[model samples]
Target: MTASSWLLVAFPALGALILLLAGKRAKAWGHLLGCATVTLAFVYGVILFFAADTKSTVDTKLFSWIPVSALQVDFGLRIDALSLTFVLLITGVGMLIHFYSIGYMENDEGRYRFFAYLNLFVASMLVLVLGNSFVTLYLGWEGVGLASYLLIGWYQGRNSAATAAKKAFLMNRVGDVGLALAIFIMFKYSGSTGYAQVFDAVAAGKFPPAAITAMAILLLLGACGKSGQFPLQAWLPDAMEGPTPVSALIHAATMVTAGVYLVARSREIFNATEDGRLIVTLVGTVTLLLGCVVGCAYDDIKKVLAYSTVSQIGYMMLAVGLGPVAYALGIMHLVAHGFFKAGLFLGAGSVMHGMNDEVDMRKFGGLRRKMPITYVTFGLGYLALIGIPPLSGFFTKDAIIEAALGQGGWRGWVMGGAALLGAGLTAFYMTRLMVMTFHGKERWKDLKSEDGRDFHPHESKPIMWVPMAILAVGSIGAGAFFALGHRFTEWLAPSVGETVEAHHLPVEAWVISVAAVVISLLGVLIAWLVFRRDVPVERPERVSFVTKAARKDLYGNALNEAVVARPGTWLARALVYVDNRGVDGAVNGLAAALGGGSGRLRRLQTGFVRSYALSMLGGTFLLLVALLLVRFS
Candidate 1:
């Protein structure tokens, strides 16, 4: 089993390498390799989950990675319930996405490169979850960031894709700095960066209040970057430039969740610091509202989902902010969101595939008749996302809300209210999307020529539908894992013993559950009333100011341009000017001065015979005078 655990990391990486070597000539082989590798990884995750001892961390040291007098690090794997859960998600959901990519990316010329990056992403994510030490984890962390940049810019010919990829990379680099600083602080304070050792030291309360606050804040910054929170969130929506499968994997299942996982893994430090917890809660609340607002305005199908990813990440952050019970709530929401969100992205892909690459929902209408399977599957996922009753999102979302309300005070209430409002907005935008894309009159007049030959949109192939169906089932039933909450808590008890009690709540859990359902329904009603009315759709110029604001994402992008981009560009230009004039000019002046002096010295070397004789006579006279003076002395 220990050997098998290593296989989990090796398989996808091996697959990626093979695909890279084979390149475009082996496109089919690339997909096959990617699917096979992740499938084996998912099976290994299932085996490890059941076989490993749940009560403690199962650390398997393969070798010593770093050895120093002051610091020692080992290459090892950690297979606890928490790690196992994420492993299953990354490999299992990742494999499904890989299979879906075969059909979705079939028309593209660079299919092999696409699958190669996907395989690499899977391998890096597994390394991230399985790593037992901070060093190993950071390796995986940066690896995923690299892969994200590569995949997002896969369509390098498109300027938007290249720009989006750069944005994602640069933003994540900011978070990476915070994470690196936190790791250093942990090693300095706790004497080790191993999860078990550092956590144990933290639980023992060896660090001061200030140190604890700094560590938590730094880790939170990393989380903010990876999870798309607050100011750092500007990159995610632009990340819609990538292929749908890439978006589904990075935004939904794997990379973004790294932040939530980091905070949860470091719960001990956070639980000890009030300021830290407050920061987490505040950031989460802000991101949730921001994402929801922006999501409501976008008509582009993938951009809407991208913003929703930001919003859902906020919900998870809220769970972490609430403390211990929120951790489980966050994890539960994480699992459920993974299913529905991935399903939603793939469904969008199916629509794009059927419409011959059309993604603007405004350009689509009456697609339900043509793409019935996609409509049904996507609708199911959307319901789950909106927190509709009996779906996976409802149960998990309510738990987080309950934890927030029960946790006490005005902050909790404010965050809880914001979360609920976000939920309502989620339904509104998603419904708007569904109606405009699938429920209206046919918008595409080019579907047929003037002769009126059939040019109808067709259903997606079985490969695409299979993953959507699997994810749809998970979206409906994933909330059942909440029933095993006690078992999960027990398994993680040793690592989080002291803070585990912080998760326990005595309030009426059903109250929040009921409220969430009612609110979701209300959102659906509002969407229907506004978008599904008999009145014709108004032009943008004719709409109200508020509607226009919502349509333009509340001018969020404009705000970002003003606040982030303008200043950054000005600063960069200023530095360039200073370097050219101040630094380079100074160095060039020094070189010119030395050359001038050397030129004067060169004149004395005149090669003429008369000049040489005069110099020799002068030299002889000087030598004779010096000898006479020395002799007299």
Candidate 2:
């Protein structure tokens, strides 16, 4: 049955193809078909999860992809602990998101098309995890980008949706260059692109330290783009312009986590260079604070959650960046995040569904009476996100916090401090969201949407609530299930190696956990104190500089425009100027000179007998003079 792993990708790919080919005709059953495909894949993945053991990695070859004497690349599936873990996460959460979409998109006319795009997205993500070679992974990598572009731009009539999709595509392309170059380096050095061959070569010191470090850095670049870390993070919040299910799936469950998977998979290369690991850790730390600071200033509910994801993934990046000691910790947080974050996004969707699609938290108040199920589920997720005990976030995230502090020395102090502060800010913003949305006065009573729609909040359908309920449970319990007795780290040991701390701890683990929980609760308390009163419908203009900066994503977009976009534009224009003035000028000048000389010479050919005789006489006289001079000499 493990040999039949091809069926995993085939099911969803086939679903997408059918939906596309069937077109409008598939509307009757397209969503059902889409859900069925992912459900089947999830069921199969569960079977494989139970059947596979810790130390065994099964490589099932599909065919000879690029057969050559100089290089060989086989298309194959790698059924290992790492790949299998991602497969289950992608398919399992993907199945729930699909079901939620069926109800969320019930009224939209293009629901069928949306499901097709979802299936394609899932299929691409599955291949990204399952592929045995970097080249194969690139194929799925591009596929996921395309599918995301399609889905994010699904509401083509909306200018924001179109622009957001373009922004996401362009930003991801910047990172993809790094991935492609890294693969080229791998092929040039190892003469193969397969994971086993490349990892083995790195292990045997076949590649130089420069090459290893370069690969590690380039891979991190790719991860940064896909995972929305640091500089490339501006696109993530904009992506919420798509459907909420798209937000839940792409941001929370599958696509954003691809970077963590990449870093974890290439553990050998990073271990070869201290600089590479430190850079990853630094990027994670910077982005963690960036996301937390910005998340605090958002009035839009979805954008708040989006920035929260940026910060949480930063924790995962930080954990993996710690090397063997915390690779499993990173992945464990990733899984737990998938649960609570997806629940939060779906809960946001539920809020929008009930509140006539208002996204500004300032416009929402006293909605718990109208949306009890959504409130309960979203509150649980919020608790999990704020690191309340017994919840998944408390377990998974606290482990990363402890690991960061365990790095020892000034490095530990810096990163661990950032992680702790991020937890506090996360609670503040999330609590601000919860209070503004579900408590306080009923702000929506007097408000009318831009579309002139009055707010009438109600519970979402069972289809939507059921998925949120299940995820809420996971949000509450997945951390304990994965972290208790070191189950998660040990399970991942076969893929990432043993979790051995290289540095001594600065303080006890319990000390770090206690500090984190206290800071988190303090954040929640401050938000409540501030927002438990009335929230004005319009944002105040007389805010501090920090508030203004946070509202603008800390000016990340402006910096990119100045540093990358404007410079690139000027360079392109300069190339065009040179092409026209220099290259075209020379060629055009030569042609004009030839044309003028021919025009002057044509006057001598007057097309008459006298003109012909005079030209012949001149040519003869010149030839005779030249011959006489040579003979005399």
Candidate 3:
């Protein structure tokens, strides 16, 4: 590694520190500084992406972090093809978000604090991607979680914002426990938690099958919590309480993807355990289907996107379970999703800005005439998300489907079928969102304000528009990289050759691609027919009970409250009561008894020198008589 690699981490951290220290007095400068820092980091990322040897690890040790008799850890950076790809995504897309935040948050009261948190988020994500050891990676992991909580709750006055932040933090702690446990297990089995050493041990088959499976599954638990998979997914939909830029950052760019990154990083161990792989596939399938179902029910624009994030992450998880080909497909999807999702979020933010904070699609209409830039960019993003042919999502989603089908069994068909259905739902909901929000007549009728002035909507400033344009371009064109899939295979050949076979079946590829396009178009047509002709937003409520159940996420929150929250609360209360009444009461009672005995003894010694002397004399006379009697006997 070179000095440029260190710059990637240092620049953003320094920017965050500067913005934090300067406070609101330097708000404009802070935004510029933040954008500049990420821009520089992105440049370095690109340089490294082209210059570095894709097959080898670029290691740079900064210093010794922990030294002990039993363990040692170093602060180091590793740049491989996978890490480099993620770095580019984080920095490149991160710069766009930062640039967009400049306009999105221009009028906010906590502008400086917002920029500070944004820069800190970028710094922590860089640490997460660059770290060479599990200890370092975990440090960055928790750091990003903390930053996410802070950003999500930036509007401290709002109770919902604080609640969402707390939920995100608490849910992530569940995953953190699994991650920490997995680290301990890895150390116990491999004697080292460094990525290099751990991979070496696994390759040599030093660990038992049971141990490997346990570690992999535990790690998957962590992935589930962080990636917003089922059961732990409640926090994400609520996370929309934050600023829209923050939603773009956390949900689209940085925080949620960490779990997928972790699983992909630990692919060797996961591949060794069939049970673990099956669990990953099942979870991905369920999350994919569930997200698509719930996303269709919501009218809140950002919430729709949040559920879509869950659904897309499900695709990434599915890719991981399919082995190496699928793993790369997952990463590919991650990158492409970052582009379009971030663009979609920013577009939503632009809409909110135009409508004076109106987020319900029912209240918005004919926005295509008012905000053409946002409409075009967001429409392109939606198309990409729905996996239209020649778009980025198509290539990545196609790769995953092909990998699943190649497995050639009922399992493959099930997972592949679920993914195909998810694609259709993605198209339907996104199209519904578009037509409802942009295609109909203006729906905002009431214009009541304190000043009694009429409300009018307008477009966002250029700062926000430019970033959307850049991301929209990426969403349309980034899939061209898949045309060089053979090259990618060659580049990754050395690292994953043993477990993954290289095969390109033209018939399989074409079939999956054609099927995806057909399903997507079907969804689009259904949405267009249902929503486009309707004048006043009348969605039919006559649906099956099972459909309604799926629409409400199967009442997941109720189940979580009953099964997880209630038991956890009761256990906590029981422990607290025992500590206060049982343990503390016993200790206080013993102290009181000892004090009472001491008081009695003090009274017995009460203030008489003559009494004390007489007692001593009586004791001496008794002792002498006893001694004389014993001698005579």
Largest TM-score belongs to which candidate?
2
Question: Whole-model lDDT, candidate 2?
Answer: 0.92
Clashing pairs in 2: none
lDDT of 1 at 480: 63
What ordering of candidates by TM-score runs from best to worst? 2, 3, 1
Best candidate according to lDDT: 2
Please write out the lDDT profile of model 1 over residues 511-560, one tens digit for every residue.
66677777878888888887664323334567677768867666766776
What stretches of model 2 exceed 4 Å from their correct place?
Answer: 501-503, 618-633
Q: Candidate 2 lDDT, tens digit per residue, 1-633?
A: 778998899999999999999999988899999999999999999998898774778888999999988788899989888988899889988999999999999988888889999999999999999999998999899999999999888889999999999999999999899999999999888888999999999888889899999999999999999999988999999999999999999977678999999999889888888899999999999998999999999999999999999999999999999998889889988988898999999999999998888899999999999999999999999999999998999988888888888888899899988999999999999999999999999999998987998999999999999999999998877966965758877788888888885356677777888999999999999999999999999999999999999999999999879988899999999999999988998999999999999999888777799878988899999999999999999
Give the per-residue lDDT digits (tens) of candidate 3, residues 1-633.
453587898989998998888887776677888889899999988987788887776778888889886788889888887778778889988999999999999988778788888889989988987898888899889989989899889889999999999999998898889989999988987888899988889889998998889988889888888889887888888889999999999877799899899988888888788889888888988998889988888788999999999999999898887776567778778988999999999999999988877777877878888899999999889988999868888988877777766666687678878988999999999998999888977766553322454447788899999999999999977867656565554554444432254254435577778988999999999999988864454445898887688667678878778988899999999999999899998999899999999999888695799989988999999999999999998
Better of 2 and 3 by TM-score: 2
Task: Give me the overall lDDT of model 1.
Answer: 0.84
Question: Distance (Å) between predicted and true CA of 58, model 2?
Answer: 1.3
lDDT of 2 at 101: 99
Measured by C-alpha RMSD in angstroms, how accurate is candidate 3?
3.6
* Ranking 1 against 2 by lDDT, winner: 2
Reference-based lDDT, each prediction: 0.84, 0.92, 0.85
